[model samples]
Target: MRTLTGVDSACSVLAGGCDSPVRSGDSIGVPMFVQTRAEGAYAFDESGKRFVDYVMAYGPLLFGHTHPALVRGLDAVAADGLVWGSTHRHEVRLAERIRSHLPSMERIRFTTTGSEAVMSAVRSARAFTGRDLVLKFAGNYHGHFDVALLDAGASARTDGGSGSGIPESVKRDVAVARYNDLDSVDALLRGREARLAAILVEPVCGNMGWVAPVPGFLEGLRERCDHVGAVLVFDEVITWLRLGLHGAQGRIGVMPDLTTLGKVMGGGFPIAAFGGRAAIMAQLAPDGGVFTGGTHAGNPFCVAMAHRVLDVLEAHPEYYAQMEALARRLADGLRAILRKRGLPYAVVQDASVVDFKFRSGPPNRNYDDACNADRTAYAAYYNAMLERGILLPPSVNEVMFLSTAHTTEDVDETLTAAEASLEL
Candidate 1:
């Protein structure tokens, strides 16, 4: 019998040779390397080639692959059980930890994924306000759910319609606004024929690269939501712990009516949460008209992992500082390299998250501006870096992450790779 190669086996079992289409390597025009193991800041492919990982499992492995503390915590918890399918102590404790940092989460409910959390949050907002319309910013992804899948308009003036299978009716109920633009949000809210239920945003845009909110942008959203009685939902799934210990809301000092959290909270496991004012959250069923539940929601194992992640973060405030320092070093080095070569590029960063855009200036404060970046240039850079044993997100629109497990040495090595890769 012949043994199957990694790509061959993956192609046979998984569509596109990867669970997620982004990992397919089609964007880079190269065959994807199948990773067999990952530890600390590096991952080893099937061929035993080591690559420094900057994706960090798309933002969940905050402590990096198979962190010792996380492994020990999971091992201890696994000895106890997997799932009891009932209320557990860990769930309650985890909720308390999250609420301590995000006071806006007066009440909380866990879900199996960030998508579910966002879906439930929208439902609760609609139920609580008895309003049908929800305004979501363009390029600020909430999940693959239909309501959140509506595409942006050809121009900012018109409301975006649904993508493929989503009904036109669903598109009518959802409005698209430009990120970091107060006027765009105000226009939609003011023109509303009926009351708007919620305005969901990514506090700090991550879906369309690592763009941040302009000054007074979030504050303006808060004011608009208050005036129109619309729920302001911050989708902090990617920015939760990546921005800071307390999340983007805490870092920016702008609070929202409801918040959705995931990614870092699970510490490489599957867990997410949605919560807000007790009155608003009370709308979720078992107690209210809005309904949401999952069998694995808040299962002990995921909850235990989440609890351990929070504990580790709380114990080590310096972890944030260290990672931030490393990120700054990397961004600075890359900027220096680009400047020396007289290349037109923009490096946007916030704390441990950074992204590169091939443009002469900073990205304009909207998705349209981000779209103008040179993808061809990025593809060339990505392939070059990958060949040099450095792994970056396959797409230019995605942000690269830094972890506590990364060292100054790792940052230096990445810079060296970037200097060579950018020559493309």
Candidate 2:
């Protein structure tokens, strides 16, 4: 086995020392702690140090890392083949399972990543509506693709995208609005209704520190889309199964014309899906003008894992309640500890996700408020927690997650570590 320093040095050969921008350890100025293996809710470093994991692979490990049942299923699937290069029963069954939970997805299409799902959904919206404009919120991240990258959240440096190679025309066709502010949406959509193709949003904004929509916000969007005849797209890439069985739409009682799902459903595999009413989804290829295809769209291995994840959920619906309860315990414990220390931090939680801002006072209501969190202070806190054997999302913009594998004991351990980390 490679030593931690050896692994760290080996990473230099990779761009930014990481494949994904968000996974770079240096992005947060922390020395990379190399994980050799993970099980349940704990990760072991190269030196065999154990840490209580709260990141949960950015919310895809709903049941936890290397879940025994899921791994066993994957092993069985691998015996047949990874990818068959043709339609298979696994994808068909997975789609049926997803549609059972999200009835709004009357028609479905698969993709290898959430970014592709968003891209296809946007194209389908445009083709179906014969319009050019797409409206997205300031801190909502659909994906890293060109149209979705504008004014995206989840970046530690800037609210605006890097703006490197994105076209000027693409930027012009997109409009950014403030989340939880219906007025902002109305202001941008006032005269552009005729040109609007879709209003894409994350029903629960996870990229900007897990900001939940205010009561009327999503309903207002639904109404606005209805008035404008533009498709309402819910980017549930992060919230999907993690939020609840029905997801954010079910949890909030508001549905969208189109929905994009990823993360939890893939069970850590590279798979995502987009679907909505059949009328709109009909715009895609083989049935309509819009075109979308990928060889790895429904990889057999990924589909098998997805089925296993759903099997667990369907068998034990109580897992959702347990995860949420643990999340509440963790969030409330942190709040109490922060208060005792006279720290101004505020903890926000919904379902199984939790976020703590470095600022004192009210919870974040929008991207700007989330940005107001002190990064320097957060970095210190993050490093301290890591030293105390509690693994957290390295970025202030990212949220912590809970899994069925996590328990009351893990929550207590994390809280104790958190309180001790503050003392450092």
Candidate 3:
């Protein structure tokens, strides 16, 4: 009924999406469909095709688009002042709110992107511990920092693996450990436990498409980190506010020494933060020595946006419950379709983050389970859904997100689309 010509053009412009050089980090994806634009739950491309959004800014648009609550918060803050080179009310308030969510945090610092927040956290760990090695999981993406560009150890590299040209020095300082496999991490630490500055993780792997920490895996890491005196950092940039007001830390109950936050914290705006024990955090800036500063680190627009976004999450903790119920409905509905078609499919998710593993059998428990899924089937399903008016994240490596804006009716319509697209 509608078309995605605009999505193509925009991606062309965004990717080359236009005429400019596509920078490595900033280019837009060739949308599965595009045209008019979007409001809440749905977007219309130039061709007027209506598609339900399954990619809510990669888990940031929790309350959906142009939310009145966010708008009001932004408007009120914006009217007061744009940016203060000095302290401001909203900044202190936001910090208090963030600390309240994760009582473990004694100090907090804001940045402009998830990458920056994570980078700062890692740097702080190195400073506080005086150790150089930073450990990260395969398939868990922390940011574009030279050290974090690693691929998961088991998954195929062709599907967005580690990049090249990084200094051997940088790569040497970083180590890649297997996801959900405690033995693998145990082995890495056996010989040189004291050298590790920090063990950075996603807690739930979204970059490799919705994998979660194995039971006892997190607590074990906590024990290991404490034994060796390394900081355990959770890169909750995507999972932070989406999982709960306190984010993955609150939901999973495995606290990290430091937490990096983004996505939902910004409410579709550019903002990120890292916080942890006060003494360790004091190692940053005028309080200590980390040598980092950003002119636009915490601009007014971002503060306004984040404060509004977070406040709403704080007010309606019930939203997370609603999102979880909706996610279960979608996951179960798709499983029924796979069963009906006699096709192999696995669904994975925690809270609002969900995905279909186009594999040969049952749902996977870790990255390996996800890698075993059927890529061809997923691509075909993706094309069919595009044709039908539902928008999903393009790459299998990314997890699908749900927002407060989607309704049961929308969920059912999506299920119908999946059934038809499955090819009986």
Candidate 4:
């Protein structure tokens, strides 16, 4: 494997030809020739090679690359100003737009990244309930906030330990539990019932692939939080803009007390947000003691782009239907190919996000189950796909994304590559 370093070579080196199977050079991990220009559904390499993008900037390209509408909207917003360090019109408009899309959000606050949004949300929970500790499920990521809670970072130490630089004390304060086990959460909530400030979770886990919460899992969390007076935080960083407008909250109908949103919020731009009841949100900044501010929190460009993106989602409720159909088509196609090849594999999917796990049983139920997936076979398949010009997230843990810009053509092409890649 070749190893290239530095920012300018970030893409070329890591994505060039020298990576390992863990740096495997095929399929989703395939290298682009380094292009100068391109837009929509496809990206160009430095050599001007056109490849359909399945990575989609880690699932933020809901409308695909450089949609003219988004470009024009951003251009208009930019003509007025770039960053005033002051709230622009898009702030109120975007908040209203988000709330309109997700009725559960009574108040919203912008942040520079998903991590900040999660941190602020956790802080709000503590201030609202006057508590300290937070609970999160193993394998369900909610950013890297000190106490915001999360599972293991990389694919080591199954019990989930202090991920390197994380302070020992920080890890100790943040509790972790098994995903899909309401009993585990209950035990923790009861053990620290009154002291529990919040319970953060990804309604549909993205890090270890799209593992949807077990039936009644989210509802049970909601009930437990209500019973203990702890805030229930839905970290929708990956599922936010991609899983319809209201996200998992809307798809599941179990609204969370607070939600941290990221992907697609800025339309490939750096943006994220958190929101909850106004009563709890009032505790931030000038309103309450909890402090949350960033010079670029609500940058005019990000807000403007996000506003336009939301408009696209809001205006076309059927977009998700299309996404679901295409996702299903792609997933079904791949699974059929595998079954025909007698490959021990299955597809775990929810809406546009999907993962190809080389497991024997039903789709994974938890991290333990996900661990059973054949990483070697997956690596081989990934290599095959990359060689076929389909790009995928490097790690098997990362799920596949289908953007709005992708059409039936893309899914069909992907499946054609999938069949060829899995040919062994």
Candidate 5:
């Protein structure tokens, strides 16, 4: 019999046994468990261990694993074929549905991934403004693309250099500012406003563990961008449908000139989009000069799943509230457990996401504060939870997600496991 030893050896055919760094276990202090199958709010590992899943496919499974509607919609759409490499009605309908909720998106463009959407948005902004410099907040991950990778989140290292092979010229065009702080943004723009093309932000700072913008912070970015003639781009990749139908911009009443959305929009498939004012989006190729195209940009299967997810959410907006309530319950339970155990920690809840930090003090307000999380303690706690059959976000900085499929009983069971885990 072949002894595989661990996940690393099992995934020998793949680089580092994972495509994404966070999926690996080198930093988490345990071998990454192999999940063989998943259902609504639960996943079973290769060993047949049942675990309550809070990872939720890293924030895309809003309706939970393998939703019946998604499965049915995709099944029906698959009969017509997956990709046509041409325009389709499903794409048009999805775009119209998204525009109905986000009026700021006067025109929209679909892409295969959030990174492509962001890259296109930046290209459009630069083309429209005839400027080069783009401002991004520290720890707000846009994607693995070169310009957006600097000062990215979800990395094991904190030197702010996400990965190698990025050119120095690309780094020069990008400037990093501290999240939730308008002063840092002002300082970066004071001497370079004329050359600034866009100010990209994750309105809710999901990458930094649900650190939302301080009051007037997003508004400040809007005003400054207007004053400087620079486009304001909100990277709502994680907060898109998860925050609300209108996204963070509509929920907070601070609209951006451009917005990028993904995750829940695909309903577990891979699809993302970016759109804004008509004049700006018109700069894309065939219409203007900036070029971006993918064979599977608006895949039929993905569009069908997105439409199904959106239809359910639009008809029953209360589902958002219910998910938030469950997340709040989980957060409250964590707080109670930590307090009773005299563990100094913070559990931050925003909508359907809950972020717990193994550190003493108030909730994290920015990337710097989020960095203070005790990874050692979190690793131990993560192992304990895993032992008890609860799968959380493997990374310390990642947020735990709640789905509509997660029931009250699941929350109670999680708390029970959490209590015992804390004692471990």
Candidate 6:
């Protein structure tokens, strides 16, 4: 194997030298190391430098990279075969397990990515209601799909066109509302009740950092959705098992009409699913009208990994508790360090997910507030931490995920590095 000097060699072949925009480190104007390997809570770059990883592959590695059980499960499945291209037992078993935990998902359909799961769920909502308009909260990203790319305008009232190549017709049918502000949603539903298909939101705001739902916010959305007959869709792709075994809806007690899940459910594999009431899910063909199909929708390897992920979650419920504790400890330590440095900072945390903003006041409640955070200060802190061999999410707007593999010692090491990093 040949090792490159920096991201330039990697970028020579790959666009931006990274698969994802966030991985590019262009936002922070820094060179992101090319990771060659990862195991447990650490990732190694091409230079063989090991950094304690807090990104955790952006929330898919609940058990951390190359977890022994996950690797073993995949090995077992590979021994049998990779893609059966037919309905498999593991897929059925995993669906049953998901439905058991998420009772709202009385029926489920598997997909290859979170984007597909969300797209299918939205399509189902439109079909079930026979409506065209779909409402999504600002900064609550569903995925990179056409419908999900629409943004709120400068007035924060008009629907801004797609940020990219999405069609105008598609953008016109979508509306953007302020997150955690139920009144904004109610206002949109009031005039468009007849045309409203669904209200899509991240139960806990993960994309714009970890801004959780305000008290009664989710319940309010549920009420509005029920009142307007719009399908309430919870995009729990990032929050699912990370919030609890039952997900944010289960922990918050505000169930949605349809739920999209990914990330931790895949156990580091590429798998995603969208499900809801039997009536709604039945709408998908070959049973009903809304078309959704993929060649590798429920491949055996991904299904086996998902099954093992669920099995681990069930057998050791203590993993959540331990990870949450570590998360809290890390948050508290960072908060103290920031205070000692006299820097204006606020740490927003939900269970094992944590994000810090370089602001003095209370944590951000919505997208606008998150945007107000000092990105320049965060970039300095990020580079400082990286120098100390502690890896954090490359962008300040992204959340740092803690996994079951992270130890108290890891948290302590992070804090020690943080204490020094804050000097920047």
Q: lDDT by residue for model 6 over 233-294, one digit each (tens)?
A: 99999888888778989989999999999988998889999999888888899888999989
RMSD of 1: 3.3
Residue 159 local lDDT, model 1: 31
Q: For each candidate, C-alpha RMSD in Å?
A: 3.3, 1.9, 3.5, 3.7, 1.9, 2.9
TM-score, every prediction: 0.94, 0.95, 0.90, 0.89, 0.96, 0.95
**Model 2, residue pairs in steric clash:** 344-360
Q: Report the alpha-carbon TM-score of model 6 versus the true structure.
A: 0.95
Span of 10 residues, lowest total lDDT, candidate 3: 19-28
Please give, for residues 199-314, the per-residue lDDT of candidate 5 as tens digits.
99999987877788889999999999999899999999999999999899988999999999999999898999999999999999999999999999998878887888898898
Best by lDDT: 5
Where does candidate 1 stray beyond 4 Å?
A: 1-4, 27-30, 152-163
Clashes of each: 0, 1, 16, 17, 0, 0
Give residue 380's error in model 6 in angstroms.
0.7
State the displacement of the C-alpha of residue 194, model 2, in Å, after optimal TM-score superposition. Answer: 1.0
- Top of the candidates by TM-score: 5
Per-candidate local distance difference test:
0.83, 0.86, 0.77, 0.77, 0.87, 0.84
Flag regions of model 3 displaced more than 4 Å: 1-36, 72-76, 152-163
TM-score of 2: 0.95
- Candidate scoring better on TM-score of 3 and 4: 3
Residues 153-262, candidate 2, lDDT per residue (tens digit)?
A: 88534334444667777888999999999999889988888999999999988988989899999999999889889999999999888877799999899999999999
